[model samples]
Target: MISSVYIHIPFCEKICAYCDFCKMFYNEKIVDKYLDELENEVNSLYRGELIKTIYIGGGTPSSLNIKQLERLFEITDKFKRNNFCEFTIECNFSNTTEEKLKLFKEKGINRLSFGLETTSNMQLDFLEREENLENTKETIRLAKKLGFDNINVDLMYALPGEEISDLNKDLEFINSLDIEHVSCYSLIIEEHTKLGINNIENIDSDLDYKMYQTICGFMKDNGFNHYEISNYSKEGYESRHNLVYWNNEEYYGFGLGASAYINNRRVSNTRSISHYLKGSYLLEEEILEKDDLVYYEIMLNLRKSSGIDLEKLYLLYKVRLEYNELVNKGLLVLDNNNLYIPEDKWYISNEIIIRLLEGIVYE
Candidate 1:
């Protein structure tokens, strides 16, 4: 039951300094051609499955003009979803408008995710991001007017030279908005990004941990569930599409630089726009062995608050882990056969997950 779908739109109005996603400048001709190819790809591969969730991630899906966005939605018409579908599109503060929001509502887009990585004007300028605070407020107002309640915003902290006061202001501003979901991520200076090339360094580890703790406390006080590592949500407002990945469920990923797990294989699409335009679609394919898949299942499930079902793990891998070994170390909690990392220990979950997996030995 491949019930989730992701479509990539690799065009952005202006590139952000921190972004490392596969993206290029928005061009009318290129967008038209890409939509045509995107439609063809959907038509060719989709098995007409009823999708439960659809996430249109980007370079910036909102960068496209009305007609271009219409064509993009037209491509998605081939697939069907049920009444509980969570259809989301990523938008930028600069490009979102009343018309765009209305168009999204008309197309049955129930969720809107905005990239407001930080609210501080200084941080925004340093990231080369220009935001109109009044306009952003208006955008949220319009989205709510259009009956969108499943709204999400991304906030980045642990910035170089950023103060705790700066992060508190961001938290206060987001709490003011009636948005239901939030994703808080620590700054990672990845190679190939402008910040990386400029020799920028990350904040001190202790400072980053402090920021993370602050965010967790704030969200908890604000009646939000710290559902996943970087995600917080109001009750029943969790991101279903994102959980598709963390739950180790299969789904389709389309467009250049997209990756998919299906037919027992991990597949990635070509990252080069020229190559994709020239019909060079695939970049790599790895057929998963049973043990490889089982390991993936464990790693991904442990990322969620619900944790891994130990019985299911045993049934799948035939490995019986000594539960007390991890529980005694204050690393894992066994509740109703679901093994999970405690909230305090989620920061170092990678090391604990590695230790737990050591109990498994494939035949």
Candidate 2:
């Protein structure tokens, strides 16, 4: 039962310096054509599962005009949703409007995620993104007034020349917003992004780790639960859509450059807009073998603080992983057959996960 769906709108009003996602500048005519293709893609592929969560991410889904948004919602309306469906759309403060919020409410969008990144004007300029603090405050107020209770805002840290003080300021502003969730990310200089092209490098590794610690401490002090590696939310406000990915569950991914996992196969759609517009949706599919499934299960399940259910893994895959070594070394915690990395050691989780996988033994 693939009970979740992710839709990608690959158009943005402006490209950020750090973005490497599949995206292009917004064009009304092209958007209309894209929506038409999206309709075709959804109608052809969806299997009529009762969707519990539907996330419309971007390239800024809120950048669309009213008519285009209406069309987009019309296409999404084809899905069968229950009374508890969590519908989310990513928005930018510069583009989101009260009218659009009203439309989203009417269409059953219960969650709104805004990309604030950072409130620092200098950092915003460096990232080539636009945001007005007053506007952001106003927009959130309006969304709340319009009955939007579940909202998320993103924060970026560890940029070149950024200090702990800068990160604290960003965290303070985000806390002031009184929103439900926050996603903090360290700056990664991807090879193809503007930052990489300009030879801009990331901050020092030690400073980056320190900044991450600051974020965790601040969120915890402010009554937020560090639910995942980069996500914190007020209790019961965790992102259900993202949990599908972390839990290694199957889902439907529609639109250009999207990926999906279904029936033990991983599927990826083409990134080229021309190909996508022409109905050439699929790019590749990899059938997962038993070993691949085990690897994925271990890697994904350990991401949560609750950790893996060891008994369930053994029963399902007939593979018993002995991690007593890691637990003894204090790199992992085993409580009641659940294995997890301590939150303090999450900065080096990748290394721990690698070590655990290296010690895997087949039954």
Candidate 3:
């Protein structure tokens, strides 16, 4: 039952220095053409599956004007998600308005994800995100007023030259909001981003790790579940939409630069906006061998707090092992039928996950 969907919005008001996502600075004429192409692309992708979760992620979905946004939503009309458990739309502080929030609500969007990034004006400016703090506060207020209770606020930690005091300030501000979900990510200076070119050379690894630990402690103390590596939620507010990805389940990813895994094949769409608009859709496709599937499944599942399900692994891969080896090695532990990497090892989960997979493959 493929019940999840992800839509990519490739337009942005202004590209942030740290962003490496597919995005282009706001251009009115170009966006109009993109919207038209987006509709066609979506129509071609939906194969009458009743989606249970729909996510509109982006460079910034809120970057669209009312007309362009409407065209995008119109394409979504083909989807029959009457059983949809969650429909989330990602927005930014600068573009989210009461009217926009209402439009989302009307279109069955129940969750609003705000790219709050950080609470500090200094950090916001440093990222070239000149959105007014008051505006962000109001955006959340409007979302809540429109009956949106499933709100997720995104924050970042360990930016260039950040301090413990800065992280504390961010935590303090987040706790004050009526947010039920938080996705806090450590700053990764990816190669193509402006931050990578100009500022990444000066990052302090120890300080960054410390900030990550602080965020985990603060969010846990404030009644949030460290559900996934970079996501925390209050009980039932965890992102059902994203779990599809971490579980390695198949779903459709439409729009430029999006990737999808379906029917045991992984496919990626063309990244060039012009090429996409000109009808060059998918760029690559790779069919997963049994071993490849196992590797991918293990890699994604380890990111969750519940870790991997041993029974599910055995059921899918016909694999088994003596659990004692990993537990004795202090890499994994079994609790209530689920396997988990202890929180302490979370910082080095990649090494541990690879080791666990090696054990699975060998046994």
Candidate 4:
């Protein structure tokens, strides 16, 4: 049964240069209509399975005013949650306030993820994002003071003109925040973004790799577990909502430009807001065959530090993978029926996953 849900709120106060997600400038009237449509979509599709994790991600969910947020919460309250439901909302420090944080706590939100991409003024300007170091510190302090502990902050690296020292400074600042989780991402200049329009280019590959290594080393030394390729967290603080995806489990994705996996089928919602407001929610669907499911399982499971459960894979898909060669080559590790990529080999995990797929054996 699906126990996780991801809701997309595609309204942002300001667009970032590197963001390519489905987003638009925040509008109160349009947001009202969007929430109405969202409630309709959820009521129509959700089976009331007692959701364990609900992630309200955005184009800045915190950008909404207090009344709008209240409406959003009323809509989400329709979902059935257990005693330990983990409700998370993505916030921007520029917009998040003490009042909103209080509302979130009262409404069952247990986690807050802020987009503090960098502490460098130049880097922030290049990204076309605004962040005040003092504000960030204050907001985090307030969240913690308000009894919210499961907090996450993002760190972006590999920007043009960014050096090792800059990256280290950013890492040091984030590590000092006392947050529970950190998600480090390398900047990729997508074709349709502001950066791409200006003919911006990615940093040198070697430099990018070096920056990633620095982040990993810093996070590790700071007592965070590198649970996933780009995510680090305190022990037991891993994102349970995201793990639903990496485990290849079914989930419901609601709102504009969201995707869902359910009943062996993949579903994507329309990115066009006009089309969405006109009551056309679905854009595409892909029905997965046994082979497709197995391929997905292999690809997604290998992303975790715990890796793939070889025996469980066999029991579920009847597909026996031959990875002795990879193990001998030191590309994969086999232990207790779990096959995983070593942390050291995670940098080339995609290539390793491709090679493993090439050697798949059907039982």
Q: Total clashing residue pairs per candidate?
A: 0, 0, 0, 0
Model 3 per-residue lDDT tens digits across residues 37-87: 877887777788888888889888898999888887887777887845588
In the range 197-258, model 2's lDDT, one tens digit per residue, is: 99998889999989999999999999999989899999999999999998889999999899
For residue 6, model 2's alpha carbon misses the true position, in angstroms, by 0.2
Per-model root-mean-square deviation over C-alphas:
1.2, 0.8, 1.6, 0.8
lDDT of 1 by residue, 1-363 (tens): 788899999999777787789999999999999998888778778998899999999889999999999998888777897778899999998999889899999999999999898888888877877466667788998899889989999999998889888999999999998799999999899989999999999999998888999999999999999999999999999999999899888999999899998988999999999988877789999999987888888899999999998888778767666658899888999898999998898889899889988877554
Cα deviation in Å at residue 219, candidate 2? 0.5
Candidate 2: regions farther than 4 A off: none
Model 4 poorest 10 in a row by lDDT: 125-134
Alpha-carbon deviation at 3 in model 2, angstroms: 0.5
Question: Which digits, one per residue and each the tens of the lDDT, describe model 4 over residues 1-363?
Answer: 999999999999889999999999999999999999999999899987989999999889999999999999998898899879989999999989999999999999999999998898878888998566679999999999999999999998999999999999999899888999999889999988999999999999999999989998999999999999989999999999999999999999999999999999999999999999988999999999998999999999999999999889999988888788999999999999999999889989999999999888887
* Ten contiguous residues minimizing lDDT sum, candidate 3: 354-363
- Better lDDT candidate (1, 3): 1
* Candidate 3 lDDT (Cα, 0 to 1): 0.84
